[model samples]
Target: MVSDKMFTYISRRLSSIKQTPLPFGGLNIITIGDFFQLRPVKGKTAGGLMSTLMISVSTRVMLIRNICTSDGLVNGAMGLGVSLSSIQNGIPIKPIEHTFMFLGHQIVRSQFPLMPSWACTVHKVQGLSLDKAALDLGSTVFEKGMSYVALSRLRSLQGLTIIRLDPYKFECSDEVLEEYSRLRDTLSPHDDV
Candidate 1:
């Protein structure tokens, strides 16, 4: 998986990639955000504004642990506010075997400027427009906002696809209560000490 830092440097150095020429140039596919549970790592904090958020290591580890176990448990039913960067990390560490082939590829040169044929984690594709998008909504953490980001990545919904999700296959925990309370306290409009 590529880190957010990787994108920062690569996006700038790869300016020529955009003009290299192809029906589909740059990154052709992208995975967007989800809101059922958490936001992206190094994202905004609880201020009702997306800018102040940042990724928390604890949140990252928890999401990774959930992915590693293949059991999407979040402590409780109302628990919320999970981070995407952590979940992306977890999927591979705890990947599910499939009949289809799966490969991990990385763009080292930062000059090729091509949409990778292999699987890429969500963090790599944010803010990028794509010709096609295949979202892996495998866990219970699936939320509308996440879906929105993924679906809207493309100029149109022509090549958008949502993988099938199993309703009876996942579990949730109450740990999210802490997150909700924290966010509420931080972002609440009315406050006084």
Candidate 2:
């Protein structure tokens, strides 16, 4: 999850380079993320070229004790908001509350649920497989093995989609390519031992 602070920083950098104001004053930039995983806690944000969301509960919840022990929704266990009601009270706002059900028990609590979506860093995605992935390889990549790690997350080529892939992003150094060629030749059936 990209924190408001980090987002602002990136937007400023981009605006400086483009010499024009970015949309939303550089806010609300849409990016890809691993949405199925857990979100970050409120206030503390994550996501950048090298950062990932730090999972934490930003909201406080009253866990209505329930009989179900299998799901870990026991008494005092924190629960996430599946739905939220409008705030009311100070600031002419109602108190923020999140509603969730645990083993038929209704739990309501107040806290920031954080952003609904975020882009995860490549390092955070290791060992996980995705059915489909949209990779945004902007103009330049900073680290080695980043391309490999991103592409390997998907099970197959059919599941991979590259966005804004600079041609230079795929280029390899001569030594690396020569080593790869040698390895390929060894695997070729026509090659003599």
Candidate 3:
């Protein structure tokens, strides 16, 4: 969606063409769309945002923004179908704002921040609680604590379906154990963690 800066530009152009100093050159304007739905998006096509996300009613999505005013649907939130699309605030459809200088001109771009959570990288699911998960420990584990981050997402083994988990193939960081100990120490005055 566009901001008032767009309106100012339009008014200036109309005034110049019509040779009138009045706003929009005294042109009669009729604005449509609900106010909540009208707030300008960061970088997305105002009305044509659906085309960018290519989302369907069935597309499961994650809410990347923390819309605190919504129904517990804030950043790092995920939901299904109509629940996502019908959000009155129109968050998922909103475009992420991107700006850069190109050829001495500022270029702006907007895009939806939704992603399909049915399959996501471990980093994406961090700090989230899942009822069930399929651990796909790739052939090579590149970093320590990667396995723990992926495995700890679920509650128990009954809720997990491991696609390929060779425990020996991946090792958790020892710092993880130490950190747990540090957290359990509630009376430590020096514990900033």
Candidate 4:
């Protein structure tokens, strides 16, 4: 759910692009999201991203610099000890010498509290298809509806993987189950349109 304010930012950015060609030599724009999650930040909707807006060249440089490699021993080493020190010290490491270095910007993982990264919860990921996904089922008692939605996002069994599934003891009233059934039956795959 895109908010009016986010739409405004996008609209302005698009108009700017129309006036002048983007500096980056490419016309690629990418959008990553699970609409069922939280609606665009209270007025900022999620949708198309601008490939080239008016952001400073330095910002683009920073983005390129942050693409850490994660391949074999060298990449995995960064996740560990002493080697991490030499790495941070400006060792001349080649980009993505290991597969771990491949930062998949296209992935939109699930969001959770106390976690270091941003993610889209199951509720928001419904009706979507991913090339690959890592589902975080979270606590058992909370958000059963969301849990179902998250698992169903992938089109094929090959693309889905559960990160964790702790046992949950939940108490559901008959009414809650009925409502869930009703909503589940009423919503078709295309209802999101």
Better of 1 and 2 by lDDT: 2
Per-residue lDDT for 1-193 in model 4, tens only?
Answer: 5533453355446647666323111234454654224222232111212223232211211111223345322211222111312455343333221112115544332211111113454433353556678877756326434565566567888987888765452233344465445445545676441
Model 2 segments beyond 4 Å from truth?
1-116, 171-193
Model 1 misplaced stretches (Cα beyond 4 Å): 1-39, 42-117, 140-144, 166-193
TM-scores of all predicted structures: 0.27, 0.33, 0.53, 0.30
Could you give me the TM-score of model 1 versus the true structure?
Answer: 0.27
lDDT of residue 66 for candidate 1 = 24
lDDT score, candidate 2: 0.47
The candidate maximizing TM-score is 3
lDDT of candidate 2 over 24-81, digit per residue (tens)? 2333457674322223223311111112222333333433233245765443334343
Mind giving the per-residue lDDT tens digits that candidate 1 earns over 49-131? 22223433333222221221235442111122334335644332222221221255432221111122244455444445678
Model 2, C-alpha of 103: deviation from truth (Å): 45
Candidate 2 collision pairs? 87-94, 88-93, 88-94, 88-95, 89-93, 89-94
Better of 1 and 4 by lDDT: 4
lDDT of the candidates, in the order given: 0.39, 0.47, 0.60, 0.39
Per-residue CA lDDT of model 3 for 40-83, tens digit only, reads 22453332223356667768787666555456766567876455
By lDDT, the better pick of 2 and 4 is 2
In angstroms, the error of model 2 at 5 is 35
By TM-score, the candidates rank as: 3, 2, 4, 1
